[model samples]
Target: MREIELSLNQTQKIRLKRALEKLESLSSKANSNSNASVSISDSIPVNLEDGVLKGHGTLDLNGELVATVCGVVERVNKLVYVRALRARYKPEVGDIVVGRVSEVAQKRWRLDIHYSQDAVLMLSSMNLPDGIQRRRTALDELNMRSIFEENDVICAEVRGIQHDGLHLQARSQKYGKLERGQLLTVPPYLVRRRKQHFHHLEQYGVDLILGCNGFIWVGEHVEVKDDMVEDQVSKPEQQKSNKNSISLEEQEQTYTPIETRQNICRIANAVRVLSILGFNINIEVIMDTMNLSSSLNLDIHEMLGSEFCVLVAEGEAERRSLTKRKG
Candidate 1:
């Protein structure tokens, strides 16, 4: 278990220890049924007559298959691989990821997605702000920085891995530059791949994007508006207003509400607590934790305190126990 450094009193320390032990017990019971944890150089039993195929994190030595990494062993048909509990993000096709722009090149932007190699977002792969499909010209290449400058945080889908490296695309309106959000990085393993990674908390007017690369974005919700409709509506208004004067709409876009900001912080802190506890992070779990904080009238910053961590640990243990019983 990873040690968490926090200030706590004697009573709080005792309570935290007990809660963590209970959580550990529950996790062990759950893992025992589904996975076999292995260490480095551990031999993986296999039937020679069946012809075993070793996959990633495995090495064949002296006609024996041994794990090359510390993780859980998984077998699929004749293929076997070890799933590392803590590792850098591994990109897969169609996975949603949030990454920061490392460099703005001629026709592509390089992004750091916590992977061994930086991912590439080509100009032809993404839709223009005007939502038009046309050939990218030299001018487009020249004005690339205007679209996405260096250090911009963007959300995109993994296109594929080619001879060069991993490529990403942002063809949809929902997948684009992210702004006014707190980006929180957690262990990629803690965030399992799911069907829906983008969530809008309507009640709080906040957007929660669980990036498969362990980049969690908590920001004020921005409605995906139709660019064509907006263009038609704004053309006449633009003619009426002075070109030098900023419009009310532009001002509104630049500002975020205080309540929304608070909610974003609250959600971000909940994710932090879950990451610190080494718990599986999902929308359901995050919402439950946020709701618990709200119910207890805990401040957003207080969620990081030792007392709240213990409470979360205990709650998680109970939740898992109930889930096991139901299963």
Candidate 2:
């Protein structure tokens, strides 16, 4: 049977997710009549021939535009085409995507962004040897992973969309690379379509890499590998093989005290108050403008700056709103 696919926006996707959850929650509240009688009017509005009336059998709807189908849905290409609203996206070229820095090659990185296959980055895509005439490295063998490093969150532009994956290129000096911090992954069903700048974060390190195939990895930073070792472990390869095993101490993460957090917040709040007066947000810009001491204000701004920077790095403005929400 012929079928149709429903395309929805980010708002529609979030709405559907919430609606589905609500239905599951209210399952126990179903009301039953003492003498249940089958009524054609109450039954799902099913029609095999002509199209069913728009929104025939809606159970729970937050907004009028969103509704569930009360009839049969056909499956094509393994996708069930229901008479319900759905979120979708269209692929295009030159779209900037914030994907997890997956496998880093000699000159490229593979992004695990829930696509058919991994995306690739080629050498000569960055501004490293910028404004110069010749290539930066004389050695053609310089590895890409070493330059960008593995799992270093990065922002790149989609050069082309392929059946397998995306052909990506890094943007300018401003729009590449990320540090260790928290991230969020929204369900692919909730995302509407491909966006231009998708690494939106809200005054935090919540970088997002929305994928079309519905796979996203939310991580602050890829934990650096355990390359650090005891004195003996760094010995030559042959010498290490000749020696016995070495004991490595586990490193405990140092936690920031609550007092420290409060102090930072106090200064940040003060800055926010001043920001209401039309001051810019950059740490240097605001600090110099306000003549606030960096010893105090700079630290707080640095903390908040990381969060705000991620919001500006995103592919879409609407998607950034998701990051702006409080915990």
Question: Whose lDDT is greatest here?
Answer: 1
Task: Write the residue-wise lDDT of candidate 2 on 143-220 in tens digits.
Answer: 444446666655566688656457777534434555433233433443335422234333332333443433332323
Clashes of each: 0, 22
Off by over 4 Å in 1: 60-64, 226-244, 247-254
Encode model 1's per-residue lDDT on 1-327: one tens digit a residue.
557777889998898788789877877777777767888999887775688788999998898889999988898989999998887888899998999999998689999998899999999998786667999999889878767888878898999999989999987777888888899999899899998888878899888889999998888777676553210100111121244587888878769888889999999999999998888899999999999999999998999998898888788878888897898
Q: Please identify model 2 stretches exceeding 4 Å from their true place.
A: 1-90, 129-143, 162-165, 193-327
Relative to the unseen true structure, what is the C-alpha lDDT of residue 172 in candidate 1, on a scale of 0 to 100?
A: 72
Cα lDDT, model 1, residue 159: 94
lDDT of each: 0.84, 0.40
The alpha-carbon root-mean-square deviation between model 2 and the true structure, to one decimal in Å, is: 17.5
- Enumerate residue pairs that collide in model 1: none
